[model samples]
Target: MATQPVTTRIVLASRPTGKPVAANFRLEQETVRDIGEGEVLLQILYLSLDPYMRGRMDDAKSYAKSVEIDGVMEGGTVARVVGSRNAAFKPGDIVLSHSGWQSYAISDGSALRKLDPDAAPITTALGILGMTGFTAYAGLRNIGKPKAGETLVVAAASGAVGSAVGQIARIFGARVVGIAGGAEKCDYASREFGFDAVIDHRSSDFASRLEAACPNGIDVYFENVGGHVWNAVFPLLNDFARVPVCGLIAHYNEEPSISEGHNQLPTVMRGILRRSLTIRGFIQREFVDQRPDFYREAAQWIAEGRLKYREDIVDGLENAPEAFMGLLEGKNFGKLIVRIAQ
Candidate 1:
């Protein structure tokens, strides 16, 4: 066999205090390790960039461990098995693996799921048919529980999870109201994702506009970007409303000390007590047992035209840092994926 070339990877240069800068990541090349028994060499094709990644940048304790300094940044990737010492996989087989920000990886077949590229675009293993989509489904189904004719409001409405939330809510016969950062994204949500209405959070009249959109009041609030959106949506929630607290990308870059408006907790408690509302926070892994069912249902929905998805793919491993930074700023219009290899 010919000698394998070195693999290039982006490593964590330093932990960021807030918004991650490009200097916080470094590119390095290292010799590819020889595959051992039951090991497979994977060439990464697509890497997912998500809001949760911001939490992983910090050394602070979270549901998931943070990426240590000088380590390859952790991520989910769709890769092709280039070489395998195991009988379960072949060289050309595509698999979904936690390969991080590297061009290539060696894995022991644990936690690697073989995928069929012909079923859908292989890149989708990182997005719509994968974690992002599952997050939306599990969060909404378990927490939101939107009913027919009920109003479902979601922030970051054009993003991966939010978009799926809106579409799925619609499929379940709910009226979907989407809140996005700008007019363009708002248009995409309303026009493409079939949201009943779209509210531009950037607008001066946002709160009032959101209230106007949800005449029946928000029965389910899919909380993605917390902060002003949360403040606005709080008052508009109907009695017994469910809030699926999935992400807080808006506050991800902020320090813990930044003071905002006065205490609204008393009023929030009053609302919760009177209305019997439910609020739940979740990580997607909590629902992996539902993956088989989720994929079957979601894939059927997508095939039957009841679901739609969008992707924002940035080419090259070198561009991953910039793409990730843009993701935090809501600069990405869809599921953000970095194309690492052909």
Candidate 2:
């Protein structure tokens, strides 16, 4: 079959000093090149927008290299294989690939995983059954270590990772308390996501409210937002509590050297020493060897209706920058995704 000649992509137009603005991204169209011997042509369907991508915008030392100026912004994408020069994939095969911010991409197939659209919605390969879900499982299981009857608190309660952390903690018989930004999200956390208690972090009485909700003291705190939310959770932690330091969306857009408020290191250390808490920071790739187990268990829970996920999908690659900016402001309600094509 003949392939289309052109592809559309969003590239990094410029680096941002703080929060990323629309000017930082540029959308352009270019001709698609023929696939090489072991490569496949992918038609991107969904693009996953995660908080960690914010760090990649800056040219600094991190676990991964920063996206260079004028380069295509990086992300996980679910695509349909429209053409293949390889034996492993054929036309119409949906696969998970790091296809970045383009409508069509060429891949060598080594880093791509074929998907069964019949098994689950193809988009899920970028969400619940993919990297995001695995991140939640691996972090919580290895660090949070929720036990039966224990209490687990998670922020960004409606996001991909936080939602998964809450549900998985419940499966292990922990009482889950979710902290979200607004009343609607708080309701969704408690009513839809099965959280034992939901607190609106935007409330004027946020710290007091969180204290009231977590009467038994927090045993496991899945740290997603690390600003005011962290300040609130710190004092509520019980002795021997476990905290898995995940994404810190609250400070993602801020300049690395800027101080948001008065230093609280002494207070944090005091709590750590007094309560003997265990805090561990992690990146999802640390648990790649456990992907098989995570996928097996997470898929089962999703299939059995024990795990529920919500996706806030925006249309078009042009809207990605604005949608991503909203993500930092807690404007998104759930797992954020971009539907680039049908």
Clashes of 2: 0
**In model 1, which range of ten residues has the least summed lDDT?**
255-264
Tens-digit lDDT track of model 1 for 1-342: 469857889999998987899889999999897899999999998999998988888999889999989999999999999999999999999999999998999999998999987899988888889999999999988889999999999988888999999999988889999999888998888889888898999999999999899888889999988888998999988888999999999788986654556777898898888888888899888987888999999999999988899999999999999999999999998999999889
Report every candidate's CA lDDT: 0.90, 0.90
What is the C-alpha lDDT profile of model 2 across 227-336, one tens digit per residue?
Answer: 78998999999999999998888888876654756778988899999999999989989989999998899889998898999989999988888998898888987888
TM of each candidate vs. truth? 0.97, 0.96
Residue pairs in collision within model 2:
none
After superposing candidate 1 on the true structure, give the runs of residues whose Cα lies further than 4 Å from its correct spot.
255-261
Candidate 1: the clashing residue pairs are none
C-alpha lDDT of residue 304 in model 2: 88
In the order shown, the candidates' Cα RMSDs to the true structure are 1.3, 1.5
